[model samples]
Target: MKEISTLRLAKELERSERTIFTVKELTSQIKDLLENRFLLVWVEGEISQLKNHDSGHIFFSLKDEEALLKVIMFRERARELPFPLREGLQVLCFGRISVYPPRGEYRLIVQRIEPRGLGSLQLAFEALKRELAARGYFDEARKKSLPAYPERVAVVTSISGAALHDFLRVARERWQAEILIYPVRVQGEGAAEDIARAIDNLNRMKDLDLIVITRGGGSLEDLWAFNERIVAEAVFRSRIPVVSAVGHEVDYTICDFVADLRAPTPTAAAQQIFPDRKQLIEDLDFRRRRLFELISERLRKLERELHHLSKRLKSPEKLIQETGERVQDLEARLRKALAHQFFLKENRFRNLVRHLEAVSPLAVLSRGYSVTRKLPEKIVIRKAREVRTGEFVEILLEEGRLEARVERIHPDNHLF
Candidate 1:
């Protein structure tokens, strides 16, 4: 298709010789007409010789496994490229198909070219880097400490990553908390969109006290997925706190800046958010033991002080002198109270004994009743055969107890 257009276009330009023309004039006309003719066609190929020119225009070749085409984009379009153009990368350029008469070679005038696998990530990185840098991730002061005792935590990462398992282990072991997962892909084409969606989902869950965005360590290109603008903005604008743990400690990305905290690894991130439950239990046990010891020591001190006070108390001589003065008064009061109290005691004594016996549990056994207790198991023997062989039994009969070992028992065969 390109070949046919090229042959026809060449002859059309050559026939224009009836009009006066210089070489420069012909090149300009060719450039203008070809540029106007084909606008925004999708060309898929591999980048072969990619170079950024001094004027900022990009010159490159797009080749497949079979053939190649020359491509050029002016500085304006070149500057907006999704990723750094490089040789050996597969790409799709949106551009006008054209011919340069001076070179007489067909070319693609690239408006914007996206690297097949790397474009979205590269675009995301560029966008997020710009925004977060403005918001101060690169700022040394903005980084904050991770939660040390998060009770409710959320994880935003692929449910399949080893990082998920690693983080879960650390969180459960350390905090024994309720962990909520807002799972998503951590890297690849739509990874940024997925991450942003997960963040948004977690934001609506009010009980989530902290969010952990993490993935296992990977190379720079792999980690670039986390550096996207939507993902970064999601972290920054989260209502609940966020902890970015995208890769290894050294692997920093845009999400790290916007997050409230940044952990070195997924496991490290979980550890940072969670307080060690075992350690907390140990601390509580120590405090309880200390309290018990303090109470025991105080009781001992009080007992010792009472004994010492008792020793200092004057007893016999002082009591005798005190009693003499009270004796005359007591004799006078007794004469008056004797008539009333002595008559009441005889009647009240029998009643008091009856009341005490009524309240006692043993009173039931004295009235032609015997209490039976079960052997070894200590169940009360409400029926005769409750005890098994080799069992010892106790019989309660009022004031005395009888112990007996089980003998062969017989049962009535008749239905009752």
Candidate 2:
């Protein structure tokens, strides 16, 4: 029986006709290892053979210097990642170590991937810079808000670096610009995180009008502290417009692109931001002179108008001469009126004389007419009834008057 068992074991363990575990048992064991038996873990690795399957699963390899391990993250886990994963980049893999049931091959079911060193972070920085710059966030038009008069400027820089001293000396000399240092490490291990925190703290400062998130200029590698995605984001998102003077002007970085304004150096940033006292005074004087010149020119023009029209002012002598001329004209009109009146009076006198000659009793006397009157009656005796016999009578002759006594009277033959 033992010999039979040995022969049966050799046949069952054949490579071509190998006796394998049943599919259900194998899968059940895999589920137990992945969910219950094995510990959840994080692994360090580089990436390779990256495949984003149509079914929404990501497949890749995590490799070290000697060997490699396969990894897979479902769409559910892969999508939560902030950045894309690529081949040959080192990353810290977070997930459970497990195996596929069918092939019995081991792989990490990745829950998250945190990139190692600066490679992954640099990729993020470059990507974000491109994105924000595309949206005009880094535009010159968006830059603003120099303090009305900035006496205090808060510096978020490293105490270990030359930034604090350089900033203080130059800023003070230029404008007596004051500095309040929020000292932090500008490079190495946890530098980016500290820098971001420092920036946040300084932004809360009440006395500070403006903030300079700067450091002494350095090479691309030496300036890894500034190139960090966290630091760049902090600078970009600051409410107080940040002046980033991180590196030389020629060496443009992601921070330079995202900051409100970029200065070539720390000293240049200070000088550029602070107001110049002399220049402001000159501008004020220039405006005052312009205003005075305008007022003087207007007054001079009014004076010239008054001078040009001096001959137009009225005088008493001129008024008297004009009045005399008017009086002379009135005298000529009066003379003409008097002449007209004399002519009219002469004509009226001639008419009156002719009328008197025609109707006067003296004219009638010259025509041989007489008016007879009864003296006793004092009436004209044109008829006999007015006379009595033996009455005295008077005659009104043409040229003379006569008196008579009536001896007899005949009424029928009374004619005088």
Question: Best by TM-score, which number?
Answer: 2
Q: For candidate 1, lDDT tens digit of each residue in 1-416?
A: 54668878789788946567898887788778777776668999888887888998889999997898999989987654434556677777888888767677779888766556665445545554775577665565654455566778888888899999999988778866788888787877678778888888888877778888889988767876676556766776677878888898888887887788788899888777887888899999999999999999999999999999999988998989989879978988988799678779967998999999997768888776877787656567865566677788888888888888877655544434
**Candidate 2 residue pairs that clash:** none
Taken over the whole model, the C-alpha lDDT of each candidate is: 0.78, 0.77
Model 1 worst lDDT window (10 residues): 119-128
Q: Candidate 2, after superposition: displacement of residue 200 in Å?
A: 2.6
Instruction: For candidate 2, write residues 1-416 as lDDT tens digits.
Output: 23568778787777586557888787777778676755688889888999999988999999999998999999997655534677777788888877676786878898877667776666755655666677776778767667767877778887777766777776766576676788777766677778788878777777777788778777655676676566766776677777888866676766777677788887788778776677778999999999999999999999999988887877889999999999999999999999999999999999999999999977887788777888867787778778778888988876668999998777797345
Looking at model 2, report the run of 10 residues with the lowest lDDT sum. 78-87
What's the lDDT for residue 284 in model 2? 95
